[model samples]
Every structure is written in structure tokens, then in C-alpha cells.
Target: MTESLHIVCPHCHTTNRVRADQLASDPSCGSCKQALFTGHPAALDEAAFDKHISRSQIPVLVDFWAPWCGPCRQMAPAYEQACAQLEPRVRLVKVDTEAVPNLGARYAIRSIPTLALFKNGREVARQAGAMGAADIVRWVQAHSA
Candidate 1:
């Protein structure tokens, strides 16, 4: 049997099982009928964030940021670009720390724009700064299992 990956949909938040090798083919959700990876980062609240981080088989790169933070605003474009580059292999997501302070506290996020890489429900790597698209992609590729 081919290995399968559990991907949570960005549109409907339903878990879809996709063939590991067929990820490049662009799969759609059975429930939502939306493309599994839309080349854009999913904006998730605490509940949605928990579902994604805990259930997804792929690595999840989270941008923990607040709306009022200048560096967070500066890094938005680069993060979105990185999301497009890393999709299908990694699930890129954004969490507005101001709106979801509990999540930031739970994750121990001390900075405004912190990038955390999580796989199999556990964080594996973290970076605290604003980085270019290339740097974000490279960092995720280097650290993600």
C-alpha cells in the first residue's frame, strides 16, 4: 500500500487522506471539494490551529504574529511567498497573536514574529525574526522532517 498523508483542509478544516507520492498532483478535499493546498497560508485561530498541528501528517510552519507589530507586518509578504513555495510538503499557517493571546502563551511565543515548525504534534524548530522568502523556505526545508 502507498503511504498516505493526513492533510487538514484550509477551506473547510476537514481532514483528508492523500497519497504521499500523489501530493504533487494536487488533491482536493472529499468533504469541501476544495484544493488541499491553495498556495496561501491558512489563517487559523486557536481551535483550528490545534486541529491542524495535532492531526496533520505534514510539517506545519506557523507564523505567530500580532497585527500591531511592525516587523510582523513587514514579514507578511515574504511569509506568503514561502507558503506558496513550501506547500504540499509543508502546511504554512498564520496565527494572529493579538487575537489569540492564549495560543501565543501556550506556545511560549515571546516575540512578535516567531516562526515555529511542528511535525507530529510537536514543535521541532523555531526562529524569532523577520526573514525573506528564500530564508523562510530554506529554514523550513532544513528543519522539517
Candidate 2:
């Protein structure tokens, strides 16, 4: 039998089960029918963030940032590039601290451009400050492994 994995939809917040072996084949959400892994970070609000963090079987990498932070803006493209390289294996998300202050506080995020890696519904590792695409990818892979 093939092992399966749970993936939360970036578009609809619905959870779907996919075969582990078929992950690279481009899976779609059962409810929304949207592609599960888009090569860009999903912008998550409070409720969606909770669902994705708690329900997803795959690891989630979140960029905790604020709109007014220059470093956050500077790291945006690198994060996007990391998403392109990491997707289907990891879920990349963005939580805007300015809009979702509760999430930032809940995570005790003291600085902008923080990267938090979650696995099995809990944070396993975190990094502060901005980083390039290769560094982001390397950090996530190291932590997730």
C-alpha cells in the first residue's frame, strides 16, 4: 500500500490526502480543485494559519514579516524563490505581522523577517533576520531533516 500525506489547500484551507509517492505529480485540492502547491508563498491570515499549521502533515515554513519592514521586503523575493524550490515537499507561507499581530505575539516573534519551521503541528526551529534564496533553502532542509 502507498503511504499518504495530508496537505492543506493554500486557496481554500481545506485538507486533502495525497499519496506520498505522487506528491511530485502536482496534486489538486479535493474541495477547491486548486493546485495544492503553487510555487509562491501562501499569504495566510489567522484562521488559515491555524488550519495550515495544525492540520498539515507536511512541514510548514512561515515567513513572519510586516509590511513596513525594509528587511522583510528585501527578503520577499528570496522567500519566493525558496518556495519554488521547496514546494511539494514543504509548504511556504507568509504571515503579515502588521495584519496578524496575534500570530506574531503567539509565536513570540521579536523581529521581522523571521523564519519558523513547523513539523507535526509544532515549531521545531526558527531563524531571525533576512537570508538569500539558497540560504533559506539550506536552512529549511537542515531543520526539516
Candidate 3:
């Protein structure tokens, strides 16, 4: 039998049980049927971000970025690659710093492309700057369960 875990829907806040192995295939929410990971980060706002970070059973990796930032744009593809590799194991997310300035200030983000790892409703580790897919995976693996 395959192990299954609950993933909170980013859209509707519904919880869905997803088999461990089907994560990379872009699992959808049972209720909304929305693609869980579309190979890109889900743009999370303040309320959704709070709920996701606090209640999600899986580890969440958030990319804090701004649209006008050159480095942030450059690192987008690498983040997507990491999502493809780390899906199910990690929930890939993105927060637009411009839209949610409070979150960026709360996190004390000093640079674009800041990645924060959250598990069990708390931040365990964080890194600044762009990293390749494998490097991102290694960073999360080292810091999270």
C-alpha cells in the first residue's frame, strides 16, 4: 500500500489526501481539481500563506521575490526545476514581495530569491540567492524531514 498525506489546497483551503508517489505528476485537489504543482511556485498571499505555512502537513518552501527584480526573474526556472524534483516531499510556493510587503519585512528579506523552509508550522532554515535544482533539493533535504 502507498503512503498518503494531506495537502491543503492553495485555492480553496480544502484538504486532500495524495499518494506519495503521485506528487510529481501534478496532483490535483479532489474538491477544486486544480493542479497542485504546475512546475512553478504558487503565488501565496498573506492569509493563504499563513494558513498554508501553519496547517500544511508537508514541508513548505517559499520563494520570496519581486517582479521587477532581475535576479528573481532569473531564478524562476531553477525554482520550477526544484519543484519538479521535490514535489509531494515539499510544497513549493512563491510570494510576491511587492504585493505582500509585510511578509518580506517580517521575514527580514534582504535579497531577492530568498527561500524559506517551513515544517510543522515553523521555519527551520532559509537561504538567499538563486540555487540550481539539485542544490535546492540538497538544502531542503538537509534541513527538513
Candidate 4:
């Protein structure tokens, strides 16, 4: 049998088993039946963020954004594209800084659309402002395996 990996559902937070080699393929949660990576950013609240960041075995890339931020709005599609491309290897999460000021303050996010890379609940790197999909993919590749 191929080695199985533990992946937490971005929506339901239920842990599911997936083949390590089939990460790029569409994997669904056994219980929730939701696609593991849907090429869209996961909307994460403070509690969800804490759980995912602390528990996810794979690297997580979080986008800190606000609704009124023009740059963030413009970059949403690009971020989603990156999420599609970097699937299974890296999980994309989005935090609404306006709604969750504590998370924004904790991460010291001064700009909208700040991309933060986390591993084992600790931040490895962060980038501010909007970036193209290619640039975002490169960044994720650089920081994650």
C-alpha cells in the first residue's frame, strides 16, 4: 500500500487519509465529502487558523486581506490560482484582518494581502502586498518542499 498522509479538511477540519503520491489529484474528505483543495483560499477565523496552523503537517500559506483593500481584491484570483497550482503540498488560507484584528496584530500584518508561510504553527516567512500568480507560486515553492 502507498503511504497515506493525514490531511485536515479546510472546511470541516476533519482529518482524512490520502495517498502521499496522489496529493495533486482531487482528494475529498471522507466524512465531509469536500474537496481538499479547491483552488480557492480557505476562509479561516482565529480559532480555525490556530487549529490548522498548529496541526497541519504540510506547510500552510495564509493571505491576510481585507474586503475594502483594492490590492487584495485584485490579487484574489492570482492567490486562488497559486492555490490550485500548489495543491496538496501547500495549503492556502485566508484571514480577514478587518474581522480578526487579533490575528492581524499577532502576525504584525501592516499591509493587506500579506502572505505568511507557516510550518508547525511558527511563521517561516511573510510577504506584503499583491503578487502575480507566477510570483506567488515561486514564493510557495521557495519556502515549501
lDDT of each: 0.94, 0.96, 0.87, 0.89
Question: Candidate 4 lDDT, tens digit per residue, 1-145?
Answer: 8888777799898777788888878899898898988878799899888888888878899999999999999999999899888877888999999999999999889888899999877899899989999999998888875
lDDT of 3 by residue, 39-114 (tens): 6668888888988898788999999999999988988888889987887678899999999999999989999889
- Which candidate, 1 or 4, would have the higher TM-score against the true structure? 1
Instruction: Report the C-alpha displacement of residue 89, candidate 2, in angstroms.
Output: 0.5
Candidate 1 per-residue lDDT, tens place, 1-145, comes to 8999999999888999999998989999999899999999999998899999999999999999998899999999999999889998999999999899999999899987999999999999999999999999999999984
Which prediction has more favorable TM-score, 1 or 2? 2
* Most TM-score-accurate candidate: 2
**By lDDT, is 2 or 4 better?**
2
Q: Is candidate 1 or candidate 3 better by TM-score?
A: 1
lDDT of 2 by residue, 46-76 (tens): 9999999999999999999999999999999
Off by over 4 Å in 4: none
TM-scores of all candidate predictions against the true structure:
0.97, 0.99, 0.86, 0.91
Compute the lDDT of residue 15 as modeled in candidate 1. Answer: 93
Instruction: Give the runs in model 3 whose Cα sits over 4 Å from its true position.
Output: 1-4, 19-27
Candidate 4 residue pairs in clash (backbone atoms < 3 Å): none
RMSD values for the candidates in order, in angstroms, are 0.8, 0.5, 2.2, 1.5
lDDT agreement of model 1 with the native: 0.94
Model 3 accuracy (lDDT, Cα): 0.87
